[model samples]
Every structure is written in structure tokens, then in C-alpha cells.
Target: MDYFIQQLINGITLGGVYALIALGYTMVYGVIQLINFAHGEFFAAGGYMGVILLNWFIGRGYMSTHPMICIGASVVLTMGYCAFLAMGVEKIAYKPLRSASRLAVLLSALGMSIFLQNAMMLTQGVFDKPYPIELAEGSLTVGGITVSYLQVIIVVFTVVLLVGLNLLVFKTRIGMAMRATAQDKVMSSLVAISSNRIISLTFAVGAGLAAAAGIMVGFYYGSVRYDMGFVPGIKAFAAAVLGGIGNITGAMLGGLIIGMVEVFGAGYISGQYKDVFAFIILIAVLYFKPTGIMGENVDDTRV
Candidate 1:
């Protein structure tokens, strides 16, 4: 039972990160029907940004005096940087291809992914960049099971982010415009909604979420790497597909499920095939129900 509880905690923590990254994929897909394969790079960039900012703070001696402030600054700056970067990517790489074929857009996204990966490698090098400070220290133990403070922070932040996203999507005027654009671009244009702006906003928001996830992962794992986005990106894509490609709630559900599956599979079965669990579930879902668990209208999503 204790073992189960421990694995469960670990799974939840991992899921929180997955859910954040998955949100980026799902949101971009939801808004413009583009996969934005480069989204993972945004995650990597965010991690690097966080570490850079945090390290600067540490060097200036601000971290020891004001750790919380330093952390907050890093999160804000990293998210902002990544959000703007994603917006620029959309404008430069994706905007011109809007009228092009889906295949062309897909290829462009892939190309951009490679470009960003190489850019990060050239700039940050191929080595792992260690975080300068630990935001959460120690752990809480209960019933012979232990949970780290970092895990608690990650889960809580994820829940808060999910709630905030729900409000943004369902309650805001911008969100309504986004939904309209997603449902029917022509009709949305006729209704005086600027689809281009909405689409850009969607990318920015998704990138912000991905950035947050990247920073959390850096703190959790103690280091960030230029190529760190690849695996989690793929897993998050799988999670998005499992939940429903364009569905926000579905993305969250899928992320949690994938996290649990991977963690439990590793704990009870074998760590060697941990990634295989998510892939198997993805394949199974695609074979059985391609539309996903809570998915509706495979093309258009309420996100």
C-alpha cells in the first residue's frame, strides 16, 4: 500500500508537468488546427530561460535574501519570453503557410522544430544546465509514504492553472472569439472577430503554459537540457491525442492518466519499458476510439 501511494504521488507530479505541456499542444490544435510540433521547443526554451534568470539572481545574491521573489521573477520572465517567442514563430513560420496545404504546414512545423532544437544547442550547448536554487525543500511523510514539497507545488500549480484556463476559455470574450474562429473562420470574420489575433493569442497562451511546465521540470529534476523537450513533447502529444486532440479538459485527463500509467508501470512492472506504457495506451485508444474519451467532432474543439 505504501509503495502504491508513493507511486501515485510520483505519477501525479509527473502528470502535472505532462498536462501543462499537453495543454500547449491541445490549445494550438484547438485554435488553428495546427499541431505546432515546435511547441516542445518552447518548453525547452522556458526551462533554459528560468535557469538563466535564476542563476543571474543567485549571482547577484538576491536568491539567498529573496528566494521566493527570485523564483517568481524567473517564472514570469520565462513565461513571457516563451509566449512572445511562440507568437513570433506563428507569425513568421506559420502565418504565410495558412493558405498552403496541411502537409506543407506540417512539414514547416517539423522544420521549425529542428531549427529551434539546433538553435538551443548552439546557444546553450549540448550539456545539461543545472538549476541554481531549489524552490521547495524537504518532504512530508504519511502512512510510510513520502511526498516532496516540489511535488505538492507542482500539483497545486497545475490545478490552479487548469482552473484559470477553464475561466479563460469559457468566460472571456477573447475565448468566445477563439471558439468562434475555431468553429468557423469565415463566420467569425463576418462577426468582426480577428481570427489572426485570436490564433496568435492562443499560441502565446499555450506557450506560457509550456514554459511553466519546463521551469517546474527543471526544478524537479535539478537540470535543464536543450534536447529535454523531445521525450516529454512526444508523451504530451500522446496525452493530447489520448484525451482528445483539441479538447482542453480531455488533455488534462489524458495527462493524469498517462502519468499514472507510466509511474505505476515502472513501479510494479519494469522501469525499462516505462515509456512503452503510454505508447501502448495511445495505440490502443487510436485503434479502438480514434475520437478520444471526451472528444467531440474530431475536427473542431470547444477548448
Candidate 2:
């Protein structure tokens, strides 16, 4: 039916965003076995960066006249900025706590999350900032279902990012170093690989992906907020867990699945419980099989 098709497209768009955010979670966990709870703030920060930069450009009377150039610039700058920001966060908050107990690191992550959230509030103010420029408002009707240009762009970009990430992780030397470190930090160091640098790179890459997602989401929704990352961040985390927390491909699969479920559940069921569906699926998956769809056994994944 047309309605189902519509929801499917919507689901895929939402899933793309979630998968982007989820990659940050999975990547950090894969390398360090520490969940960067503050990763969501990186998403929020990206949105903020995009809007602020666009606002500056619009003030100069240029963004609207050159949408593509403005957008491309914003994305690149935001990703770069957030990448460095994430590295700084790792150096300040996580690096010091690396050898601490798991509980200590977890608490540290939580504290950092709260700190970042409030810091955004204090710096950007507790108000929603609208994206200054709007692009690609056209829509196409296919099979009695209409899809917006923005949706198409988001999906395409998501695919490109995922493919690029796959090539990076599976085909490149840095990726091999990443895997080696993940497999055994001690052994990898013995072989001359720098575990510390690899870990920092992992954070930077993950934050960059999340930043891209944040910019897209801000443009799609027409607004950004200081606390906007909270809910979607939680959903993305659920996606990561659902697909197998430490697996890159699993994060993508889990994100799409979560997105579809959330959209379809809201469309066919009740919107009030839409968020609940993702968590329930996560709980069910964990209960049935402790290791995710593509995850290795617990013993094999020791940190």
C-alpha cells in the first residue's frame, strides 16, 4: 500500500540517521570497550556548528545563493571540528580513566555526558536554533508514495559514508591497525602499533560520522537544539546493542531495523510508544542471544 511505502521511505531515512550515530557508539566500544555516553553531545555539537556557520554565511548574504557550496562547507567544517572535539574529550575524560575499573569509566562517561549537555545549554542557550538556509524542497511521487529530495539526499549520503567506512575498516592499513588493537592491545603494541593513537583515531572517526548525521538531521528538521541529541542518542545506542555493539556492520543493520520498527510502529500502532519499541527489541535480542547477530562470544571479546 502507499501508506506502507511512505513509512518505509521515512523509516529508511530515520534509520540512516540512527545508523550514523550508532557508528560512533560501536566504534568506540569496539576499540576501547568503553561506551562514550557523551558521544551524543558530539551529534548535538555538530548540529550547533552547522547552524552557527550557516547563520554566519546567511548574514553575509551568501548561503541561500549558493546552497551546495554552503552545505558542503558546513558539513566538512562541522565534521572536522567535532572530530577534534571528540579527541579532546578522550584525552581529558576517558584517557585518564582508561585503567580504572569499568564502573569508574562508566560513571566518568555519564558525568561527561551531563557536563557536555549543560555546557551546550550554557553556551548556545536553551533555545531551538533554526537552520538558516533551506535546500532541495522538491518531492517525487513513486508508486503512489511521495519522497522528498532531502530524504533522498540523506539516504544517499548515508550509503556513501557506510561504504567509505567499510573500505576504511576492511581494506586500509589504519583499519588493520584498528582491528589489531581491538583484538589485543598488548599484542598490537608489541608489534609496534600505537594503541593510544589508534584509540584516538577511532574516537575521531566515530565523532566525525556522528557530526555528519547531526548536520543532516538539523537540515532535515529545520532546527537544532542544545539538548536535541538525548533521545536519538539513546535510540542509536539501542540500535548499536540490537545489531551487536562492537560490530560495524551490525550497527548499520541495527540502525535500519530500529528505524523501520520505530517508523512502522508509530504509523500502524501508537506514536506514544514508538521509542519503547527499540528498547524492547534490544532487551529481547539480548535476552535470547547475549551475543548480537554478528557479535562474537563474550569470552572472545574480552577487553
Candidate 3:
């Protein structure tokens, strides 16, 4: 039982990271009906940015006196940086192809992904960048089960972000406009909602969330590489598809399920086949329910 609980906590922590990344996929797809293949690059950028900022703080001798504040500042800056980067990518790569064929837009997304990944490789180098400091270093043990502070922080932060996102989407005027635009772009434009602006905002929001995930991942794993985003990006996309691509709630559920499956499969079976297990579950889900676990038509409930 204790072993089961340990794996469960690990699964939730991993799931939270995937969920954050998956939200980017679902939100961008919900608003623009285009899968941004370059979305994962934003996650990579965030990880690099967080490491850069934290190292700078350490160099300035701030980390020793104010570690939490330094981390908070780095998180905010990295999220903002990625948000703007995503908006820029949208305007440069996607906006021009809006009226073009879907194939053209998809090709553009692929091109952007390749370009961004290579850019990171060139600028950041192919070497793995290690995190400067550990955020939380302690652990608690109860009933023979051990839980780390980092895991608790990750889970709590994820819940807070999820709740905040839900409130923003369901309770705010901006969210209403977003939903309106998603449901009917032409109709929403008729009401002066500015579909273009909403689409850009969607990209920014999604990238910001992915950026947060990147920071968490760096902390969890102790280091990050320029190519780190590719695999996790694929898994998060799978999670989004598993939950229902355009549905926010579905994405969250799908992330957790994928995370849990991977953890348990690795724990009980071969650790080398963990990635395979995640995709197996994805394929099984899609085979049974083509729409996904929460599959629904693109409507007001989406996004």
C-alpha cells in the first residue's frame, strides 16, 4: 500500500506537468482550429529562460538571501517571455496563412517547430543546462510512504493554476469573448470581439502555461536540454487528444490518466517501456472513443 501511494504521488506530479503542457494544445486548437506544432518550443524556451534568470540571480548574490523571491521573479519573467514569443510566432508564422488551406497552415507550423528547435540548439548549445539551485529540498514520511516538498509544491501550484484558469474562462468577460470567438468567429467579429486579438491571446495564455510547466520540469529533473521539449510535447498532445482536444476539462483528466498509466506501468513492468505504455493507453482510448473521453463538438463549452 505504501508503495502504491508513493507511485500515486509521483503520478500526480508528472500528470500536473503534462496537464499544463496539454492546456496549450487544447486552447490553441480550440480557438484557431490549428495544432501549433511549435508550441513545445515555448516550453523549451521557458526552461532555458528560468535557468538563465536563476543563474543571474545567484551571480548577483540574491539567491542566498531570497531564494523564494528569486524563483517567483524568474517564473513571472519566463512566462511573460514565452507568452510574447508565442504571440510573435503567431503573427509571423500563422496569421498570414489564415485564409490559406489547412495543409499550408500545418506545414507552416511544422516549419516553425523545426526552426525554433534549431534556433535553441544554436543559441543555447547542445549541452544540457543544469538548474542553479533546488527550490525545496526536504521530504516527509508517513506510514512508510515518502513525499517530497517539491512534489507538494508542484501539485499545489498546478491546482492553483487550474482553478485560476477555470475561473478566468467561466467567470470573466474576456473568457466570454474567447468562448464566443471559438464558437463562431464570424459571428463574434460581428459583435466587435476581434477574433484576431482573441487568437493571439489564446496563444499567449497557452504558452504561458507551458512555460510554467517547463520551469517545474527543470526543477524536477535537475537539468534540461534544448531537445527536451519534443518528447514531452508529443505526450502532452496525446493527452489533449485523449481528453478531447478542444475541451479544457478533458485535457486535465487526460493528462492525469496518462501520467498515472506511465508511472504504474513503469513501476510494475519494464521501466524502459514507459513511453510505450503512455501511447498504448492513448491508442486504446482513441480506438474505443474517437472523440476522446470528453469529446464534444466545438462549442461554447470548449476552450
Candidate 4:
């Protein structure tokens, strides 16, 4: 039972990270109907930025005197950096192809992904960048089960972000604008909602969330690599599809399910096949429910 609980906690932490990344996929798809393949590059970029910022803080002697504040600042700065990066990518790579064929836009996204990935490799080097181990050193143990402080922080932060997103989408005027634009870009533009701005905002918001995840993942794993985003990005994409792309709630649920499956599969079976288990579940969901769990009501739930 303790083992199960331990694994469950791990699963939730992993799932939350996936869900954060998945939101980028679903949100971009919801608004523009285009899958931003470069979304994962934003995640990778965030990880690198976090390390760089934290190291800078350490060099300036801020980390020793104010560890929590330094970390908080790093997260905020990294997120903002990625958000701007996403907006820039949208303007440069996707904007011109807005009216082009879907294939053209998709190809552009793929090319951008490759370009960004290579750019990171060239700028940050191909080696793994290690996060400061001191940032997440402690763990709490109870009843023979151990839970890391980093896990708790990840889960709490995920919940806070999720709830904040819900309020943004359901309560605020901006959210209403988002929903309206998602429903009908032309109609929303007729109302002076500025579809282009909303689209850019969507990209910024999604990239910001993915950036946060990247920072958290770096803290959790103690290091990051330029190519680290590829596998997790694929898994998060799978999670988005399983949960019904464009449905926020479905994405969260799908991420949790995927996370749980991967953790349990690794714990009980072979660790080497964990990725296989995650994909198998994704394939099964695709076969049985192509529209996804919440995708049946896409018009109502999108954005």
C-alpha cells in the first residue's frame, strides 16, 4: 500500500508536467486549428533559461542569501522569455501562413521545430546542463514511503496553475474573448475582439505554462538537455489527443491517466517499456474513442 501511494504521488507529479505541456498543444489547436510542433522547443528553451538564470543568481550571490526568491524570479523570468519567444515565432513563422493550406502551415511548424532545436544545440551546446542540486535536496518520509519536496511543489504548483487557468477561461472577459474567438474567428473579429491578438495571446499563455513545466522538470530531475523535450513532448501530445484536444479538462484528465500508467508500468513491470505502455494506452484510446473523452462536445469545450 505504501508502495502504491509512493508511485501514485510520482505519477501525479509526472502527469502534471505532461498536462502543462499538453495545454500548449490543445490551446494552439483550439484557436488556430494548427498543431505547433515547435511548442516542445519552448519547453526545452525554458529549461535552459532556468539553468542560466539560476546560475547567474548564484554568481551574483543572490541565491545564497535568498534562495526561494531567486528560484521564484528564475521561474518568472524564464516563463516570460519563452512567452515572448512563442509570440515571435507566431509572428514570423505562422503569421504569413495563416491563410495558406494546412499542410503548408504544418510544414512550417515542423521546420520551425527543427530550427529551434538546432538553435538551442548550437547556442547551449549538446551536453546536459545540470540544475543546482541544492535547489531540491530534501524529501519527506512517512510510513515507509518517501516523497520528495520537489514532488509536493510540482503538484501544488500544478493545481494552482490549473485553477488559475480555469478562472481565466471561465470567469474573466479575456477568457470570454478567447472562447468567442475559438468559436468563430470571423465572428469574434466582427465584435472587435482582435483574433490576431487573441491567437498571439494563446501562444504566449501556452508557452508560458510549458516553460514553467520545463523549470520544474529541471529541478525534479537535476539536469536538462537540449533534446530533452522530444520524448516528453510526444507523450504530452499523446495525452492531449487522449483527453480530447481542445478540451482543457480532458487534457488534465488524460495527462493524469498517462502519468499513472507510465509510473505503474515502470514500478511493476520493466522500466524499459514504460514509454511503450504510455503509447499503447494512447493507441487504445484512439481506437475506441477517436474524438477523445471530452472531444464529443468540442464546440462547447474548446478553448
Candidate 5:
């Protein structure tokens, strides 16, 4: 039971990160029907940006820190920069292909992914960068199971993010625009809704969330690499799909489930092939519920 609890905590932390990153994929797909394959790279980019900012700020005495202050600054800066990056990507690679076939947009996304990976490698060089956070370590015990400070932070932050997302999607004007755009772009445009702006906003939101996940991973795992986005990106994509690709709530639930499954699988089964567990779940979910847990593939409902 203790072991099970430990695995559960571990899974939740991993799941939180996955869910955060997966939100971008699901959101972009929800409205645009195109997977921004390069979305993952945005995670890596955000991490690098945060670390660089941290180093510069600290080096120049522009910032001093209590642990909380440092973390807050990193989080805010990372989110802003990533949001900008997302908007830029949408304006450049995606907006032009909005009127084109889905295949064209998808191919363009793949192109962006490749370009980013290569660009990061060329520019950042090949190395694993250290985390800027100097986190205080402690563990909280619940039901005889202990979870570390990092794990707790990951879970809490994820919950806050998901709650904020829920409010954003279900309670706001922009959310309505997003749903309207997702349901039918032509109709949305006819009604004076700027589908372009909504789509750009979607990408920006997704990028910001993914960057937050990247920040958490950087602090918890202790290193960030240029190619780090690939695995987490793929896993988060699986989470998005499992939850119901276009459903925001579904994405969140799926991420937690996937995280738990992978963690438990690694702990109890073989750590070497931990990744296979998510794919296996994905396959099973696909076979049973092709539209996803919360996804309405053919439904025309708007928020």
C-alpha cells in the first residue's frame, strides 16, 4: 500500500507536467484541427529562456531571491516569452495555411518541428543545461506515503493551471470565441468573430502552459536539453488524445491517468520500457473510444 501510494504520487507529478504541455496540443487541435508538432520545442525554448534570464538577472544583481520570488519570476517570464513564441509561430507558419487542406497545415507543422530541433541544436549547441532553481527539499506524508516538495509543487501548480483553464474555457468571452471558431470557422467569420485572433490566442495560451511544464521538469529533473521536448511532447500528445483530443477537461483527466499509469508501470514492471505503457494505453483507448473520453469528434456543441 505504501509502495502503491508512492507510485501514485510519482505518477501525479509526471502527469501534471504532461497535462500542462498536452493542453497546448489539445487546444490548438480543438480550434484549428492541426497538431502543432513544433509545440514541444516551445517547451525547450521556454526552459532555455527562463534559465538564461535567471542567470542574467542574478549575475547582474537585478534580482535577489527568496526561493518563492525566484520561482515566481521564472514562471512569469517563461510564460510571457513562450506566449510570444506561440503567437509568432501561429502568425508565421500556420495562419498562411489556414485556408489550405489539413494535410498542408500538418505538414507545415512537421516542418516547423524539424526546423526548431535543428535550430536549437545549432544555436544552443549540444549540452544539458542546469536548472536555475535552488529548491528547498522536504516531504509531506499522507496515508503513510511521503511525497517530496517538488512532487507536491508539480501537482498543486497543475491543479491551479487546470482550474484557471477551466474558467478560461467556460467563463470568458475569448473562450466563447474559441469554441465558436472551433465549431465552424466560416460561420464564425460570418458572425464577425476573428478566427485568426482566436487561433493565435490559442497557440499563445498553449505555449505558455507547455513552458510552465518545462520549467517544472527543469527544476524537478535537474537538467534541460535541446531535444528534451521530444519525449514529453509525445507523451503529452498521448495524454491529449487519451483525454479526448479537442476536449479541455478530457485533456486534463487523461494527463493524470497517463502519468499514473506510466509511473506505476515503471515501478512495478520494467523501468526500461516505461514509455511503452502510455502507448499501450493509447492504443487501448483508441480501440475502445476513438473520439476520446471527453472529445466530441462530430458534435457541434460550443461553449
Candidate 6:
């Protein structure tokens, strides 16, 4: 009972992180129909940016003595840096390959991923950087189950992000432009919409969301490693596929479900097979619903 509840909370937190990462995958897929293999690196970038900025502030004694304020500052700096990095990635690795074969774009993306990871290693060194955590060490008791501040924050933030994303996609003109671009790039351009700009915007938004997840995960785990994005990337990709490759709402659903399965399966079944569990769910989803929970279309985009 209590144990189940505890694990459920853990799963939700994990899912929130994955969902955030998956949004990057889905958004990019929606526009360009290729997974940005380098998407995961943006997560690493966020972690690195946050830790470096926090340390700078701490060393300079510019912030108050409050740990939370320092953490918040670090998070904000990370988000901004990652947004820039995402836009830069669009200008460099992806823009040139947009018209190339899908396979070519995919390979290019893979190459970019490898390049960035190694570049970070060469520049930042191979050692894992630690994160500064400021949350008070305590848990809130609810319905006979204990939940930590970390879980609360993860769930809360994910909800806020999801709501904001929904509004951005459905209510705003930019979002309408995005949907139009997704529907038909040629038609969108015929209507005076810049497909190139929309694509870049999609990438930037996806990367920004992933950046938030990366920073949160770093703070939660108390460390940031250069290669830490791999597993999360795989899991988030699975979530994106499971929910529906190009469906925004589906990505959220898939991420939460994946998170729940991973956490509960590990706690109740075997920790060694947690990664396997995530993939197994993905496989099952693919097996039964070839197009995923939400169906995919010819354009690989959902308006």
C-alpha cells in the first residue's frame, strides 16, 4: 500500500522527466521527420550549464545564503544557454541536411550526436560533474505515503510545462503556424509561412523543454555526467514512439506510462531489468498499434 504509493510517486517523477525529453523528440519528428540524435546532448548541455553557473555564483558570493535561490538561478541560466544551443544546432547540423534523404539526415544527426559528446569530453574532461541540491531533506506525508520535495516539484513542473505547451500549440498563432507547417510544408509555404523558420522554432522549443528536464534531473541526482543523456534519451524516444511519434499529447501520455512502468517494475520485479521494461512496453505498443497509441500519417506530422 504505502510502498506502492511511494513507487508510484517515483514513477511519476521519472515519467515527467522522460515526457519533457520526449517532447523534443516528437516536435522535431513532427516537423522534419527525423529524430535529432543530438537531442539528448542538449540535456547534458543544460546540466553542465546549470552546474557551472551555480558554481560561479557560489564562488563569487553574489547570491544569498539560501540554497533554493542558488538552484533557481542555476536552472534559469541553464535554460537560456540550452535555448541558444538548440537554435545554434538548427543553424549548423540540421539546416543543411533538411532537403537530403531521410537516411542522410538521420546519419548526419547521429554523427552530430557523437561529435558533441566527444567534444564535451575533450573540453570539459571525462569526469562527472556534481550538482548543487538545495531542497530541505524531508518528506511530506500524504495518505499514509511519504513523498519528497523532489517528486512534488517534478510533477508540478511537468504539469505546468504540459499546460503551457498545449496553449502554445493550440491557442497561439505560432502554434497554428507550427501545426500548418506540420500538415504540409509546401502548402504552408504557399500560404506565406516560412517552413524553415517553423522548423527552427520546433527544434528550439523541443530543446528548451529537454533542457528543463536535464537541469531537473541533475539537481535531483546531485551529479551531471557527460554521457548521462544516453539512457534517458533512449527511454524518452521509446515514450515518443509509444505515445505516437508526432502527437504532442500522445508524447505526454507515453512518457508518464513509461515512467510508471519503469519505476514500479523495478521496485516490484527486478531493478536490473528496468531498461528492458521500458523497451518491452515500447515493443508491445508497436506490436499492437503499429502507428502507436496515436496513429502516424504519411507526412509523419500531426496538426
Model 5 spans with C-alpha error above 4 angstroms: 62-67, 141-144, 299-303
lDDT of 2 at 126: 93
Please write out the lDDT profile of model 4 over residues 58-155, one tens digit for every residue: 99999999999999999999999999999999998899998999889989988999999999999999999999745676899998899988798899
Over the stretch 1-303, how does candidate 2's per-residue lDDT look in tens digits?
889999999999999999999999999998998788999999999999999888888888787688678778989999999999999999888899888998898888888889999999999999899987675788998768999999999999999999999999999999999999988999999999999999999999999999999999998999999999888898999898888889999999999999999999999999999989998887888788767777877665442
Clash count, one per candidate:
0, 0, 0, 0, 0, 0
- Cα misplacement distance, residue 218 of candidate 2 (Å): 0.7
Q: What is the lDDT of candidate 5?
A: 0.86
Q: After aligning candidate 4 to the native by TM-score, how far in Å is the CA of 160 from where it should be?
A: 1.1
Model 3, C-alpha of 165: deviation from truth (Å): 0.9
Q: Which ranges in model 2 have alpha carbons more than 4 Å from their true place?
A: 300-303
For candidate 1, the 10 contiguous residues with the lowest summed lDDT are 294-303
> In model 3, which runs have C-alpha deviations exceeding 4 angstroms?
298-303
lDDT of 4 at 48: 93
Q: Report the candidate with higher lDDT, 4 versus 6.
A: 4
* Ranking 1 against 5 by TM-score, winner: 1
TM-scores vs. true structure, each candidate: 0.97, 0.97, 0.96, 0.96, 0.93, 0.93
Q: Give the TM-score of candidate 6.
A: 0.93
Which is better, 2 or 6, measured by lDDT? Answer: 2
User: Which digits, one per residue and each the tens of the lDDT, describe model 6 over residues 131-230?
Assistant: 7545446789978898887778878988998899999999999999999998789999999999989988898889888888998888788888889888
lDDT of 1 by residue, 30-111 (tens): 8888788999999999999999999899999998998888899999999999999999999988999999998899899899
Say which prediction, candidate 3 or candidate 6, comes out ahead on lDDT.
Answer: 3
